[model samples]
Target: MADVEEMLDQAREMPYGEARSILLEQALKAAAHDRELAFEVRLELTEAYQYGAEPAKSFATFSRSVAEYDADPGRWSDWHTYSLLWQFKWIASDMRRFPEIPLQRAYDALEEMERRYTQAGYGSHAIHTQRTYVAEHIGDRAAADEWFHRWQTTPRDDMSDCEGCDPSGKVWHLAWMGRDEEAIELAAPVVAGHLTCHVQPQGILSNLLLPYVRTGRLEAAAAAHLRAYRLVQGDANYVDDFGDHMEFCALTGNETRGLEILQRELPLLDRSPTPSDRMHFAGCAALLLRRLEDLGHGGLTVRRDGSDVPLDRLRAELESDARDLAARFDARNGTGEQTRRLEARLAAEPLVEHLPLTPHARRVAIPVTQPVAPPPPPAPPSCSTWPRRPGGAATSTPPSPRGSVTTPSAARRTGGARTRSGWRPSWKASRRRPCGCGSARPSCTGRRATRCGGRSRSAGSACSPRTWLWWRRPTGGCSRTATRAGAAARCPAWPRPTRGPAGPRKRSPRSRARRRARCCHCWPSCRSTSPSRWRRPARPGRR
Candidate 1:
């Protein structure tokens, strides 16, 4: 029989997947005769299973370690025991991903961790942090808020996540609260090249990408994507990170860049063992591919499994896969939170008109308002179009210039939609307020009101507000002057607050009244509609 130490070393050298998992399994069996060795082998095996191709098995491995430690506490060292406790969070989080596991099981896992931590004289920081994740996961905002506060107030101990990870968690929660400004502010310390770690800058940078874009920090957003993606690439543990980068590219008019990211990451999709990571990756891939299709690149193909797969087919497969996985998560959680969040992600608009990316990108400024470029004259006969890869290689046509954005018409050009200011919060999108295009929003089957509800009221439906596409119109009865006026619906191109926690958060009465007073109630039934009457939103403080 192979020495367990030798087997574990071999497994570590191997890449993360079924093969590595199998090797660790064998080593676990070999170490079973030696209780101390078995505990050591069990801890290592759990980490492999947690990140390898079969993540569900990790919990099973973790379970055995716990039973052994409890059964003979004198046999295990403090190092082995602490190692097992640290993994409690991993089990708690991943258990919620599968539909088969009841949510109660996840909470039980957390309670177990808390009990053990308290017995060991550890601080409550890690326990409260995990409780926050559980509450937030199930869409229980009040409970999540209470837990988050406790997590914040509890002092860190030997068991809390490293300096990098703790702050990264805070950044994500802040972004979730729809406080992009605060999220970015909190991330500055990590982003300033201080306190770096494998997870630090990557985790911090990915969380801030969309926040920076939504706040008109286009250059910062671009820089973040480039910096963060490099760290996460090719790591099985960073599957969630890859999905975030893909979503960033899709939202920043970098579909081609997204395609490049897709080509690199798609092959590793099956290698990822966690259901939640796979779900996130599929959803983001579908988002990027949808943008490609919208830009007339539906015919384009990506190389997969030694053959080219058309992106349209790829998009359909990913969307179905995402929804299916989301359904499973929703079934388990019973709140439909994952499903609703996925739909929001699929429906979000770009935050930037044409923000550049990476080392090769050029500085592009988005004006508050610019002359609508006249639709280019019909392509001259023989002016053929070609699909160009980000590396400057052309796949098809001969006449088009290199590095051109693949948009169809000036009016419908992908990425042409621009925000008026940095204020396209997705609450407006979630409201599904009707655009003047006269096309009724389909998802909003809710009972339509004959009179516009303005901002605070909703009729009969749970359907979403609308897509990223919308047009603006000017109205006269508005208390706020018509700069980015309420006469028309907002654009679908603006970045909606997808991960922010505060999207559907309840508003204060004073804030609610303030929102009501800003717009006219002339939508869906107003007879007056004219472009000539439209005016640019007033510059702040301008008379």
Candidate 2:
């Protein structure tokens, strides 16, 4: 037994293909020693094969394990038998590509598992949960509801300690019941915390996204879709979840990105995906392409390696694949329920178009007892209220005082100035400080001047004429005018103009002649010299 366990552990540490081979070899060796040990080893081998995408091999191995256990039931415990039956039921149902067991066989297996659980005095929550799922899949709403209630009310002590399993199952049941709003409410916290197992996160979040979208909760739907997408991307083991991710992408205007993912994953489908996986991927591809067709891109094209393939052709191919897979499932399962559902879902009519923009639940508003506060008083009219100046330029005015406002033009016309104390006559007219250029100085002639050589002006002095000139000129700095006309009339910085020489000196005749001679040597066009003569001679020895 220990040797079998050790071999299984070692197999787990290897890649799926290698692990499946090792486990199969170990199971054969263990069969020679003990039937019980052989059964355990084969169980591990079955999972390895499944993970490696060899569903046929996995089903055969699992069947052998079950037969070995049945030959001598005393060798295996009830718990082991129950677990085996539970797993077998799911595997059988998922055999959509090439089913080896009928749907009735899966249901019978579930019934046997339930009997084993009851015989062992254990609650049948897991059994009931699986029953609910099967019922829902077959569109047996009443049976599904009854099983859901059974699962919900049953004690969970005997159920596996998978943290996400219970909530994810409940969410699925609620969503199928058309109670999507309730399902989303329950799933929001789980998705937010990123609590997920191999199976639950993809199932829970993907199911939640549909509700979110239907209820105008696009942001939440997008977030859930992204989380679900990241969970399955690059991991072929989770291809079962890929269809749900693609469906969300199509509904949420992410068809382009979804199409890229589909193209990338298409090659993997040919590499021996399970029947369920093949059906799912093909059905989702068909549905998405159908939606694209309905959106007016009837001749949509998929580009690969500079080659373009019509989307309709791709859709037709996928639909054919899905139908073929469904036919195979129906052949083995002896029931076309799931296949029929798949065909119905992938029909040309758009399912998303029928979804409501909001949830059916009405929001209830809570009443408050506190009195509402009054709104603040209107603001005083701003300087913007003043008329434009005669030149069509906006006049600048200071912010209005607490009780009174002053317009620039009005202040100028009234010959009054606003001061900290209040409105006052303009510095008593005569006593007002002279302009920075000096009251005795003449007005600017609008000509350029030499650099200042006067005494350094005080830092607080008014703006200089150069500053004012720059402020007033179109291409100069400080395009905005002063807030007050009186201030605009004065230099912001009062720097006195220097009396230095103001213009460039005239060049001497000899200097002018030399410049012309230099120019003639540089360019033959200046003196009409021959091109060869105009060129400077190379250094004597270098030539």
Q: Give me the candidate number with maximum lDDT.
A: 1
Which window of 10 residues has the lowest lDDT sum in candidate 2? 468-477
Best by TM-score: 1
- What is candidate 2's TM-score against the reference? 0.58
lDDT per residue (tens digit) for residues 13-47 in model 2: 77776456766676568766776667777777777
For every candidate, C-alpha RMSD to the true structure in Å:
29.4, 19.4
Off by over 4 Å in 2: 1-6, 15-36, 76-89, 92-100, 271-273, 294-308, 324-344, 347-543
Off by over 4 Å in 1: 5-23, 51-54, 358-543
Residue 147, candidate 1: Cα error in Å is: 1.5
lDDT of each: 0.69, 0.58
In model 1, what is the error at residue 324, expressed in angstroms? 1.3
lDDT tens per residue, model 1, 299-344: 7888989999988888888899999988888788888888888899
